[model samples]
Target chain A: MRYVLGLDGGGSKLLCVIADETGRMIGSSLAGPTNSSYNTPEEIELSITSVISEILANHNIARQDVSIVYGALPADGQLSISTITKNLHDGVKVNLCGEYVLSLFGAIQEDYGAVVQAGTGSFAHIRTPKTEITVGGWGPILGDEGSGYYIGKNALMACVRMADELGIFTILQERILTYCKQVKMRDLCTLIYATPSNKQSTLIASLCPIVGKAAAEGDKVAIDILEDAAEMLFMQASSVLKLPDVEARFPLTVAGGVWKTNPLLFNCFSTKIKQLFPQIDLRYPLFEPVIGGVLLGLRDLGFPVKAKIEELKHHFSAYSISADLFQ
Target chain B: MRYVLGLDGGGSKLLCVIADETGRMIGSSLAGPTNSSYNTPEEIELSITSVISEILANHNIARQDVSIVYGALPADGQLSISTITKNLHDGVKVNLCGEYVLSLFGAIQEDYGAVVQAGTGSFAHIRTPKTEITVGGWGPILGDEGSGYYIGKNALMACVRMADELGIFTILQERILTYCKQVKMRDLCTLIYATPSNKQSTLIASLCPIVGKAAAEGDKVAIDILEDAAEMLFMQASSVLKLPDVEARFPLTVAGGVWKTNPLLFNCFSTKIKQLFPQIDLRYPLFEPVIGGVLLGLRDLGFPVKAKIEELKHHFSAYSISADLFQ
Candidate 1:
């Protein structure tokens, strides 16, 4: 029985899975962050190795049986892949690319479609038969509109504005204060500015679920923020659709933590997209990007993918992965 | 002759002016930045000392002849005042406070009125006859709507969105890219994220003039950004006006670099305010905040302000000090 390995390495955590050539998932494991921008290359290599070792040990699979290793890594995580491949069992083929590309393949089961990845940051990617284009991946400073970081930062600004009497009062103001363990709004500056940049991004992104909770409870400020965020995201997709090579009817897939966790945001985003492009089909990815990696690996090896794709979809139906586990 | 000194210390530079008891202009000098948040306490003290020493030396005045020293320091420059006082000649009384407060006194010639300081940062202050209220001085990260920093940040974001084909194309895009010496639009992320935080704020705030130039040339994106900025500022003042203790028809003084330099932004903001509150009388400050510090010093010393106010206004008209000199 030939087997393959797939990994999804992000800024927050890493998910690894091993499956048979028929796409039956045999075992999986999780580990710490492998984003090379945030961690040393050695750290990332260690993390990838530990997760892979755990999977093999648990499933009683020989290292020689694994023929391919594919990873969907954060933009900065490209540095660690060579080290990971060399340390793994000899003769295993390794492929690594941006996490978004893997997510794109996973969502549509092919490279040609639109995918908006909205997690700690956000970016939209569209792959046509001949070419591909990306939008809004400039990180938090320049772009990342409709991202978790964007939403959380706006939520924080709204809270400050409310405290300064420049905005309407909302329960979100009190909730954010409590969430940060801050007694006075003025002290929020210390909380935000005093932290290191990476941790700061994470701290701000962590507020997304809180904002979503407030929106669910009918907080006007929270609703407005989410609505504005949804519009920004829809604009990203609309821009990608305008690319000369992009097909108008291709599936538009939404992925990442923001879409999965915030149903209100997703509903707003989907409704706006539907209103604008009624002909386009929208989809929630059938499986996580790790599973997409498996599909990508099989295709790279010139293996037939139709049967494996269907099998993976069937497997995902029975696999109940907790969202909290990844975060 | 008993002389008083008033200094306006900001992120960009320090302005020191010396005048006699009758508010007659004697001597003035400028020096590099003394903002304690950006510079070390030693650096700030040196900058302030150099400016004061230059004024005394050039004007042939003895240090002991100066009886009062009042400074309007930036939010972060509060540390340099004590060092400044301790280093000054004996028998001189030193007073220091937030730059916004001194701007309020300078613009209104009293301790009370509505004053909005919209330079690199923005904050609104309302001093009613019986009580005082402040709004939106939370700095660039949390609030600073309608500020130079806010306008510049929006312009950078507009450029990124334009590059990504997610926003309307505008002249500001070319101008910002050129201004930053970036050959490619994507390089802006490196330009923005690579700088130290203080220099980053200064660099971003520097884009304000480019945005203003684009707005003057009628770029739609620039116009929209300024219009949005204008609304945010108007809301700050409008909120302060709604305070119960605020007088119905007090002078609303507009001060700071944004209003001083960008006639288009000022026009938009003033027009919006006029449309919303016809009862409020609008005024441009007759003197800079350094002179406001003088007014504050005089007030603290129990000097009658009416004559001195008239005298200072007359002096400022003849002062011929270039705004660029301070910055």
Candidate 2:
């Protein structure tokens, strides 16, 4: 019974799933960030090796027993990838894929479609039979419009505008002060600017949930912010739909914690996209990205991927209950 | 001579003008940044003392003979002001004014009007007969719409969007690459993010001129960016104008390096503003902020401030020929 391992990661954490050739779940493990772009090579290597080792040990299996290892990470901003498999078992057949491909494979399952991810950062990936392209993943500063960072930063901007008396009054002013545990909102600048540059994106993006809370509470400012963010993200999806090669009814899915955590944002985004492309098949991802990694390995072995995916998800439904997928 | 001194400064530099009680120009000195919020109190004190010392020494005037010392610094982020005059002459009355007041007095000269400063950051100040108010001076993070930093950042955003193939292509993509000495527009992220947070605003705002260049050459993306920035800032000025106490034909002036460096942005903003508030008296600044400090000193010494402002500008025009005012 050959076993395959699937690894999916970002700048913050990694999730791994190990399964048999038949796609029966064998074991799994989690580890720290392994992003090649943001994390040092040393850090990436340590995360990959330790997690693989932990899973092998946990399932009472040897590293050499694995049939294949496949991993996916964010493709944007990557400067170099070097010697990642130096410590892995020989001939284990390790392959690394871009996060967009991982997400696409997980959701569309080799079909021609588009995937939009809106986690801490945001980007859109469109996959045609012959071509694949990503858009708007310019991180926090250059792009990431309608991502967590964008929504969170807009919430802060609204509060200060209210403070400046030029903006309509928003409850976010008091909410932010309460959330930040400060008398004034200006103290937030110190808290945000003092953070290290590498972590500042996450620090700012973390405010998304608070904004989500405000919108849920029916705060107009928060609602406006969420809707504006929805519009921005929709623009990326719209841009993809406008590609000459894409079919009129091409499939598109919105993924990431941002969509799941905020009903208002999700509903707003969905309404806008559906309004523009009425005939398009808009979808929520059917399988998480880690599952996509596993399916890639299954496809390499020439197995009937659709059957194996269903079987693995059926056997692992309770196990996949972790919030790991949403984040 | 019972000389009076006026000092106006920001996070980047300090400009000082020394004059007799009648506002006859004596000597002047330029020094490093003395912003109390971003700079160390020690640095502020050092800058103030050294600049004052330089002017007194240059003109062979005794520090003890100085009658009054008035300075204006940005009021938005100031945590506190320590003793900035400990090194100066004993019994010298050192009064500090908010930058808004300095700009206000410099332009309106104690009249009821509004002053908007659009330097590296953006903010608006209104002076009524009864009270004073500042709007939208929330620094780079919270506000500063249509500021140098805002326009510069928007230009970068447009370039990356074009690279993503989702935005209209603009010459700015090539211009930014050449400006930063990079092969691709993405390299700009590295150049910008690598700078320290304290200086990042200025570095990003520095891109304002390149954006101005593109707009002058008729890049639609660049033109759109400048126009959007103009709209955002116009909202701030419009908000101030809407106040119940402000007159139908209130006096207003636009001040800052941004206004002088970019003629296209100026015209776009001016046209939009004039179209909306046709009755408004929109004037360019009559005197620079440091001279505003001089006017403040003149007003304190029972001098006719309008005459003194005119006299000082006439006599100092040869020296103000320095791009120091534009910057």
Question: Which candidate should be chosen as best, given DockQ against the real structure?
Answer: 1
TM-score of each: 0.88, 0.86
What is the overall TM-score of model 2 with all chains considered together? 0.86
Error of 1 at A167 (Å): 3.0
Model 2: per-residue Cα lDDT over B1-327, one tens digit each:
587888887788888888887668887888888765578766776777688789989999886887777788643223223343454565777777777777776665655788877889988888888777777876676678999989888888988888877788899889888887889866777777667777888988888888878887988888888888778778888878877788777888877778777777667767877899888888766666777777677777888866545566776574342333323
Candidate 1 chain B least-lDDT 10 residues: B318-327
Error (Å) of candidate 1 at residue A248 is: 5.9
What DockQ values do the models have? 0.61, 0.50
Candidate 2: pairs in clash: none
